[model samples]
Target: MIRTTGLTKRYGRVTAVDGVDLHVPPGVRFGLLGPNGSGKTTLVRMLLGLVHPTAGSVELLGAAMPRHAASVLPRVGALVENPASWAHLSGRANLRLLDAAGSGGRRRDRRRRVEEALERVGLGGVDRRPVRAYSLGMRQRLGIAAALLRSPELLLLDEPTNGLDPRGIGEMRELLTALNAAGTTVVLSSHLLTEVEALCTRVGVMDAGRLVLTEDLAALRTPTGLVVLRTRDPARAVDVLGRAVVARSGDTVTVRADDPAALNAHLVSSGVAVAELAAQRRSLEQVVLELTGPGADRVDPGRADRAGPPHQGDAVPVRGGVR
Candidate 1:
């Protein structure tokens, strides 16, 4: 439903969005992936006609942007940056105002749309509460309700779960999943890779100002049939596993295996001591770095720094072998 070619946008000498072409078919939950300052928001803005691109062309719902923004935008919903609502107004009140200003239809129709949106986002019961009294998650749902006020064919959300806790994030994911299952195409832009993995069917990776890669999540997640194993005796385990061994160093061995679980079991059955075993599947994060080359992770070092340390999800505990 959206296509762009050679889409370029610049702010003086610095190009915020390079010549990137994006194709989003109907009914796909698309994720735009990037680190901070990777031109994600800029691309979305250019598509929405909120920002004028310095070069290239865009077609939204088969109409050229800005030129046909009025007709096309009514079918596109967006929550760019962060969505805001009048603090003093009730959630329903905020949506009512948005529906009137944004969709422009009969007052009765708009009112019905407001109720449907509130119910759709699970804020139906709390719609009477003022927005300022809503939790961060509730406010986010309200923002999405405002977006859905137009019954948009396509929904654009930038970091929809940005500041929410784990529970809130889970709720947002479920809501987005339901929306997509109900046939609204969603384009979600996020710096968090895990969220993209959880929510998107197709993904586009951005680096600097360019689109480095785009692929279906399944295709991109193809297993390499590689496994990394830490063993009490690497040499003996390698000898026992025979041709499955790929490389060995210290007490660790990398093995070629389509099934790490079976391989681990076999090794233990043969009495090879496995300390830890982990599949070496290439993650989207790792593939992104490979595409962007070295130092890609340093784009905004301070961002990662401020976020503190990374998690230890990669390591698997296999004290006695494949536990």
Candidate 2:
């Protein structure tokens, strides 16, 4: 539902986003992950028509941007960075205003939408409370409610889980999952690797103003391994499986294997412990580092590796337009 070609943005002599090409299919939860100053927010603004791109084109829901932004924006809901909310207004009042100004819903319809949105975000009871009096989590939920007011087909959330506690984060995850299941296309940008691993089906990693890698979540998972044994001697079992280097806390001996069942049968006939065995896979964080290059653990894992060879047609220079 979203596509970009050669999308570039620059400030003075520095390019914040360079020839970014992205494609997000319908109902897919695509993630834009990058470290600070990697141009994630800038790309988002360009997509929303809030910032003019220096070059290239963006299309959303089959319509080109800026020229068709007004027509397309109603179908999209966005919470970029921190939400803009009036401190003095009640939560319900804020949503009501958005409904009126953006969607032009009637009084009764707007009220119902406001109430439903608040309830969806778990803020039904505090709808009457002023936004300033609400906690940060509450305010974040309120922002989400406002974005949902129009029943948008596309939701763009930038760091939606920022500042949220564990409980709040879980709540947000559940909410977004429910939305995607209902056929809403979601594009989320987050610095939290664990959250992305849990929530996103596909991800695009950006660094140095370019996309480094894009992959399905399943493909990124480390392969699982299994092992087997035969002899009852624990010492012999350890010795068979490289005992000196491999550490065994209890009954199980941990070793990397491609086929656990095969290894188990082989060990059983070899006079090793004929007991049970299991397999373990590396975490998502490790896989991410491996794909994006080493030192990613210390550097921002989200940063795209733009220093590599330039993508096709990306070398073509273009001029920036007026805001």
Per-model TM against the reference: 0.79, 0.82
Per-residue lDDT over 114-175 for candidate 1, one digit per residue giving the tens place of the 0 to 100 score: 89988877777883667788887787777877888777789988888866888878888998
| Top TM-score hit | 2
Any runs in candidate 1 off by more than 4 Å, and if so which? 104-106, 127-129, 228-239, 246-254, 258-279, 293-323
Model 1: pairs clashing at backbone N, Cα or C within 3 Å? none
The residue-by-residue lDDT of candidate 2 on 205-300, one tens digit each, is 877678777878777665655343333566667776673225555565666677777767767777775666666656566655554433223445
Give each model's clash number: 0, 14
